[model samples]
Target: EPEVTQTPSHQVTQMGQEVILRCVPISNHLYFYWYRQILGQKVEFLVSFYNNEISEKSEIFDDQFSVERPDGSNFTLKIRSTKLEDSAMYFCASSEETLDQPQHFGDGTRLSIL
Candidate 1:
């Protein structure tokens, strides 16, 4: 049973600093995604990637956000600038086959922007 792993269990940064969140799914997966949850808000879809390209993205994924699969097993999300409102738990997920398949999620990285 493989799983998705996220780095920097927690991050504390300035409001304007750049942040990179990394995830590694220990399986031959093709679909990857990034989601975020504010402390008291719902889980919001950020972006999805396949074939080394963005397959779907929510409005939340603006010019400030970007996703990349820099390697075969690793996917990353970079925030050009962190805002105080951006503080939340970021989750990385991957599906072995397609978007219709179930996905495995990481423990989530709690980002606190001050």
Candidate 2:
């Protein structure tokens, strides 16, 4: 079975610094997405990518944040400048065939900004 994989199980960064979170789903997935869960808060959708472009994005994915699939294999989210409020658990997910299929998610990457 194909699954999603994420790098950096945990990260601690200073405010104003930059951090990149990475993910790799199976080769067949046509959709990719990023979500964040602030401690004690519900998970929120950040962005989604498809066909080499952004398919959807939430207000949280502002000018300071960006997502990319630099290679066909790795999906990445970059924070231009970290902020204390950015601390959260980031989840990467993918659906192989279509939205009807269940999304496969990676064990989240926890980001901590000081």
**Residues forming the 10-long window of minimal summed lDDT in candidate 1:** 95-104
What TM-score quantifies how close candidate 1 is to the native fold?
Answer: 0.95
| Per-residue C-alpha lDDT of model 2 across residues 1-114, encoded as one tens digit per residue | 678899999999999999999999777888999999999999899998888899999999999999999997999999999999999999999986555788778998999999
Q: Pick the lDDT winner.
A: 2
- Shift of residue 15 alpha carbon in model 2, Å: 0.4
Cα RMSD of predicted structure 1: 1.0
Give lDDT per model, in order. 0.92, 0.92
Which residue pairs of candidate 2 clash?
none
Clashes of each: 0, 0
Candidate 1 lDDT over residue span 3-114, tens digit each: 9999989999998999999999757888899999999999999998989999999999999999988877789999988999899999999997773689889999999999
User: Which candidate has the highest TM-score of all?
Assistant: 1
Give residue 34's error in model 1 in angstroms: 0.2
